[model samples]
Target: MTVYPTRLTQLSLLALVVVSMVLSLTSAPTMAGQTYSYTLPQQAYSQSRARDYQVYVPDNLTTPAAMVMALHGCKQSNADVLADWGLTAAADQYGFVLVAPFISSYDGLRNENCWGFWFDHHRHQGRGEVEDLHQIGLAVEDAFAIDPERRYITGLSSGGAMAVVAATAHNEYWAAAAAASGLPYGEDAASVSLTGQCPGSASFHSVSQVASDMAAELDDDYPIPLMVLQNANDCTVLQTAANNIRDGHLQVFGSDGSSQGNSEASSTACSPYYQDRHQCQHTRYTENGQAGQRSLVETIFLDGPLATPNLQDTDHGHYWIGGEHGNNGKWSVRVGPSYPDIVWDFFDRHPKNGSTSGFPVITLIGNNPMTVNLGEPFTDPGATAEDSEDGQLSVTADCSDVDTTTVGDYFCTYSATDSADNNTTRERTVTVVDPNTPIETCEQATASPDTHIATGRAYAGGTSNLRAYASGDNIDIGGSFDTWSQVTLHEGVPGSWYSSEPAACGDDSNPGDTVCTDWQDTNLNHSLAGRAYYAGGYFSYGGDDYLGAVAGLSSWVRETAPGHYQSGQCP
Candidate 1:
């Protein structure tokens, strides 16, 4: 018997693996299923040092069965995971395939025969062991007719933490996740050893922060549910870690840890019936009171009479509880309310609803609609791209079209492509405006006897009174004012303006009535026919489209400002 390192310190792990090799020579437990070795294909996108894995196909297993990836703890083999964790029996009973992958070789810093969950390279998808494990799962899925929605992952101790990392980093890959006696997502063995707490040190992000970071590019609409098993008497991992896991997942699912419309399930409820059943307290959390919303988080803490030691830390309560009776080994305890049974039940209820391409999403770092003044230098704020498979990708920005010297609307385009060739593009509008351009104003002289500036509101598509002076009678101007046009009066020639024809300028018979002169469309100025004149040059009220116009008699006009003009004044 070897004293396995239950914790994930590099030094302890290195020493433990040297002796654990002896146990592999011993005969494995006789399971109802057949177990075989699988060498995972090396992925060019990953830096994984571990590849060898094992699979257990239950007797009489059929197509469309569920698949579970079981990661083993430190100083443990894949065989130990299947036989010790009672997954072999569970697979036989539930008719699901069991995939047990372990660290076959010792990476310099990562623990030998243990998961690299605490290592930065392996914590995310498509990088290190995370990618290796994902490839292994895919390989198994291809080999067997596994249901995509029924995929799941579970682990113990260091493996437990890896399970969380995998499920979060690749949310679309797994339907559910369970961790037994595991550390939080970002916690390190050193910090956990010192404080016996989660979110171990400030050097690493908190559990909630890790969860949020993992979900930054994930779809929030379909969050993966999580189940955590904590041994209350376990001093190796500490029970506080379970709280961190529960709280972190609650944040991921946008739950406040309380039932919105459904009655809250008590955390103190424990199952007392099963053989050798420890006082197992269960707590469950749901996203909301929605009719079909299932529990997003669940926690089970086991505490009772201490069982005989299977290996080191069994007395510490850090081993897997409720395995096969009378056939216990390293980290395996024959206690009640079986861990495998509980995990399988939780996983069965939650399945993925839709498919995801694992595509990268490009998110603009700054404002989507940005403003840049004319003649000022314009700098693109840039963007960020993240993928479910590829962690972070380089974003290319094409802002060459955004010229600040010109007063017009422009766009800055950004795009990113992942290693898998999944690409995404995003655009931000850049508007350039000339600040020096003069704003047209309507100044009404209150006491001027020659002119009166009357300000009125003009509606769109109204009958036009101001005419361009056609062949004989006063004809309406062909161009109408834009919508919500403002009617402003300014002091100008009392006659109406006509298009280039001098004959159309005046009504010779009633000479004092309608006076007209040359007013071109190129210039902003125009003249009115009624008592008031369109004195102010054309100006935009908000943008370059709106212009000052004369109010038609039929148009709805409330006098914003009023002034009197002598009726017969002509210039």
Candidate 2:
């Protein structure tokens, strides 16, 4: 047995020693992805003691990256946050870090776990939990290469409630924040009564109350932009609660500007005023749909004093993860470019300390000719400038020299200036042309259907009166066609016709009268069919009903005579 206690025994001894050493070494526990979970120091709270959070850091850390803290809802764990949100993939793709903290419960029951803070109560109640979150944020900054300026907080349901609380309470720490299916403020006693025993009422606070408290903390000169997302159909948080929070902000900021119009009926608009007297856009989203269905409301707030409102249709029931709801209140997650992209875009646009430099481009309507006259007043184009920082826009035009006499091209330039002094100029062109010309008097114009005589067509022979109608451009002349002008005709050679004009023929002096001479030879042959004929002279018919080659008498030569005379003689 002196031969080193059998090979198997020696290996077993070695394994035991190794296990003991590992237990003593304080190594982190490994999880699903080989990620390590560690615990921080515990803190005390009103109902329970706070525990350190578990965070997952990607291995691809090279440079500093944005940090996103995803808090868990009531009765949900760090692991639940991870699994439900499935944000690891997004973190990997977007090159950001993720941290999830646990809100330990008094009861050992894991399902009782929740974020310690409440929306409708005093912040002091959740001191331990808030401290833990603050520490966790600081710890993340220390543990990972985090861009302090780009830190963000987002969550779902209860978690979302906490995220809003954290972001609004600690605005200095977070660049931007988003909450899904979360109330803007905590539940009050009345709200609790309405919704039944609100489980997270310990630290609930009204959004208006919170805003009032936070007013002092906010930069009076420039406040941070806050974006809120809520399900119109969220039965738990109730969309009205969120509206109260937004209204509080409006009251503090002073609603001195117009709200941007939106089509979503459930949405309300508000604006925030900065110290610079500029208006920032703020909007509230709410549930809007028939009962028993899903709907969504979203709102964005800018940094200015004035608010602009925009809205869109969204899904209901706490859909921050974005997908169909699974069995256990879990949402089936699907990653998209929009969520992370919007997060980054909003973060990029709004900086911590009133810096609008390097913001994204926003285009606004410039002054253009909505209407223009043919030649009268000269119109000039106007434009205004837009900037990522100072959106103040004003447009001016130089229309003093617009030429009305010339029928040619005219150009007007407009200059725009924003609050930051950024300028943009645009020009619009207008053209003037002469009014459409009227057809010459008595000219032949075709008539459709040939049922009634049209203006500008000639009439030859018979009792068919040749009428002349004239239409004026840019002027109005009143009278019926029968009163304007008339023409008459008479027989010349057998079957031939002669026409006469009122003034030209000495017989029919009345302006509306008609006379006939050799109309077919004079007017019909000279112009096309349907052309108006200006009879030059008058003529007469046979005696009684027919004056033979008689002078001074005029009659219209009817192709069909009244008596049916085949030859030239009255019965």
Candidate 3:
């Protein structure tokens, strides 16, 4: 008889996880790899209670491979857990690290080998099971180079319950976690005793009740992706347990315009598991992060009509059992699905920064090996940067001492650091050259003197009756040279015409006291009448009351000569 799934009712709120994979591989013989055990550095399981787990390292283990911490149900060993998931060949083919941690088997009467999934002692923080698992994952990180965004956790039964608890409490440490046949966490929630057999009579709390408890424990803003796998006819852990898990996830992951569209998945077979008459349907809900990237939460339903205690473990399918009709397993319970591919595909899409390396890239622009003329302006060509986490980044530049005015080579550096502290830089060389030929001579300018016609002579006293000197004679204003002082002193001669002022009268014959000798006018006119003036006039020897006999309606003018000024600079 096949058990059909009851229609799920709409719950108020909950959660999201990774995208599915499409890779198809044949289920080859289980090539058992080397499984090694690791001991906890510090005592976490229980004081004095030794804690250790085993990991299967494939022969072809590559750098930065994805890791999955597969947890086993009660009475299951690490090897059994790995075998149960049917991931040995898949791990080899997909190139991932498969880790199966056997829950520390305590000597206690109650806390034996089973994970303390639903217990008051394990619910809260501080020296507890959840903290221990987180530390172990961190330890695993230290031991391997697994991608932070590719690290995940999945389990069966109580181990499944622990997966849910660990993922929610410590979302920062994991990329995603899928709990197969698990229960909602919290001390108040209903639970079953691991000491008993499969399908114990334990009543599960309502989905809302579980959601309320989770809402209190988990941060409302913490939206990590979750994938819940439910077995419809599960009696070992009832179908309602899976429903509660799904509803709680949906509630915690609010649809407050923060999340993206939903994707529904259905497949006849994925690999070794689903091939043999098993059915699978998946629903993936995602949210666009502030960077417009993807964060997801997915839930898968694996159930179909099968008899009670179905020899294939079909009815109480407490495992992720599906495959592409390989129909290859020692027992009906062992053979099933292509879970690894679905998981890998999902993890591939969601990194801390949208399938990116969580870093920024800096690109340089403008002239490289730039050649510029001396004295010419050389502007720095800048750079740009981008980061998936921080989006488009701001950049700054530094030119390595390039003198555009002087001829030389220089380097310009462009750099930027994203918000995530990812640094990027680029450099360019700039060469400045003086390409113009040199010049020898430059232009020159000079000035020459012109004739100065005196306005009149500046005299010591009045000169009356001296040819009736006009009012214009002997007048000085505005500091203008009163007398005809602007005269051409012939190369060696004192003056042919000097201002007749007392001290400057070259007409006098006083030795060393302003005297003149052999002086001639512009027309070779020389007067020896004790004192000579221009226009053929003469002032008497002693007291020339005529004030040196005014010049002929005196007037003055100036002239200049051509110059020889040089180019580049005035010479």
Candidate 4:
């Protein structure tokens, strides 16, 4: 037997029920993470403007883990990006620290939380957004033991452009970078907007031109591998911007725009990440570096049928592709390739050393096997060392065991050590012989010895001239050598022994003496001059005058006869 409740009591019960339901629906999900906030004071690097940023440290984070700076698109908040783009979950699963910076509304170039990547000040190191972001990275390092070799940055749209800026401007601080639906670095707003409307003329600058700009602005020559993602139907950022980014990065990496070829991607050979979504075209660019052919840039183009009839639909346009369904914010899609997984995978392959480890690459500059006369003072040919994070490092040689008095085989060890305690060492073999021992001719040394044939042209640098070898019926170096008069020397001479020292010429040269050497140039990036035999000396390509130029010993020879040069001491 139940008693009927009064109208007042029933109304109170209904109100309590409504309040309970509201609280249940609006309660935030329990997360095994903690969020910290900070406001960077006005500093020179930040253009004397205070900037705010947030960091999300997931539970069970291990020390020396990778830190990914996750940037949000226009009109988006850090919290919105972390949740909608599944960055929070990615942090928890991947065990990485995430940093997100907020654009101040009071800033002169602020556009609804868009980063100031379009302006010149924002594109360089220690200036505007690039500096603000770098400060945030430094702040994170203070709180965590982030792997200096594993620091990476990625973003979408405007954030994508800013990521490019930060990664390139302070390139030494970052290991790798990824951008989705973003404009090329240093692109003006007018150009970007115009390209967005007219896809045909989307690329404002040539790929090589853009690459030159990027190379000029880099803090170090160590190329930062970049991953570019684009949607085929994206009308906002358009496919043209992605093309610019992909091609420009490839050019900077010295790649020829050739794909690494993944059969599972783009083709029907394998299903897309989402069966119902569009397929992705995966093209990877590789260059022959000191480490061999290595992947430097990868472009992921999402292609398939559109979700709507309108081409300008923002809902189906530029976004962080493959975000969680029903939980994404504006510019985040639930279909196509998974950006988080793809970007992280790419970043994991490339570290500060250009590999998974911190070890630097040590390259011997001169010849590997060298010959010296007994009782003659042996001057060791130096080597060049480079690390991805540390840039160029000082190389030290250990020639203590060498005894010029005795004739035997010895080793000269060259080593390079970085601040991270990572080290690399290389060896050069030195052979000492009796002073009376006759030097072996090229025919006696090898079955087939190529001729020391090369051409030279008088450069118009007033005092400077150009002399390079012609190999295999073509000018060894790519480019036009036309209109330049060819001066031949060292012809008919077998290329057996090459000198590592410059020829004594001009006031010091005595007549009727010939000195020549075949020199091999070792550049880690493989972008400059190549292996060639030159007379009248070889300049060290490792300098400011050329890309990836390192300071080293130059080789020179004097002309004694027509088309004939010999390797001997200068008189």
Model 2 scores what on Cα lDDT? 0.40
Ranking by lDDT: 1, 4, 3, 2
lDDT of 2 by residue, 324-438 (tens): 1111123322221123333433444454543433322222122222234455664332333335444434567665545656666666666766654565555555555545422
| lDDT tens digits, residue span 1-571, model 1 | 1122211232122322211111111112346667766565444564655377777887788878889999888767786676557677668766899888867775656445767777777777667887777777877776678889889999988888888888777777899999998776766656344343332332334766756666663543567888898877666676677777777667666555443224234354333213445767766666563322456777887775444433233355567764432124466665555677678766765667633344565555434456788999998767766454554589999998998878999998888998878787777788897877532222222221111111111111112222111111122222232223232323212212112223323236855454333222322222242222433423211111223353322221111112112221124
lDDT tens per residue, model 3, 202-257: 67777667767777666435466677776675656667776677666666675643
| lDDT tens digits by residue: candidate 4, 1-571 | 1122222222232222211110000012334677766666555443546666677777889888889998888866665565556566557756788777777543565557788777787788766777767776876776677989889999888899888888778878899898988777778775344333423244366666777788888758777888888878776677878888877776665545433332112211111232233656656565643232335777778774434311112444567754332132345644455566567656766877756556766655444446678999999767766565665689999988778788998999998998899988877778788967534332211111122221111111101113222221112211223233333322112222222111321233565444444323233322233222322333222121222234243333222222222232235
Find the 10 residues in a row with the least total lDDT in model 1. 451-460
TM for every model, in the order presented, reads 0.53, 0.43, 0.49, 0.53
User: Candidate 1: which stretches are off by over 4 Å?
Assistant: 1-30, 194-207, 217-221, 255-274, 289-292, 304-307, 324-326, 354-571
Over 4 Å off, model 3:
1-33, 41-48, 107-112, 187-202, 257-274, 288-295, 305-315, 322-334, 356-571
**Which wins on lDDT, candidate 2 or candidate 3?**
3
Query: Which has the better lDDT: candidate 3, or candidate 4?
Result: 4
Provide the global lDDT of candidate 4 against the true structure.
0.57
User: In order, how many clashes per candidate?
Assistant: 1, 51, 60, 10
True-vs-predicted CA distance for residue 199, candidate 3, Å: 8.8
Cand. 1 TM to true fold: 0.53
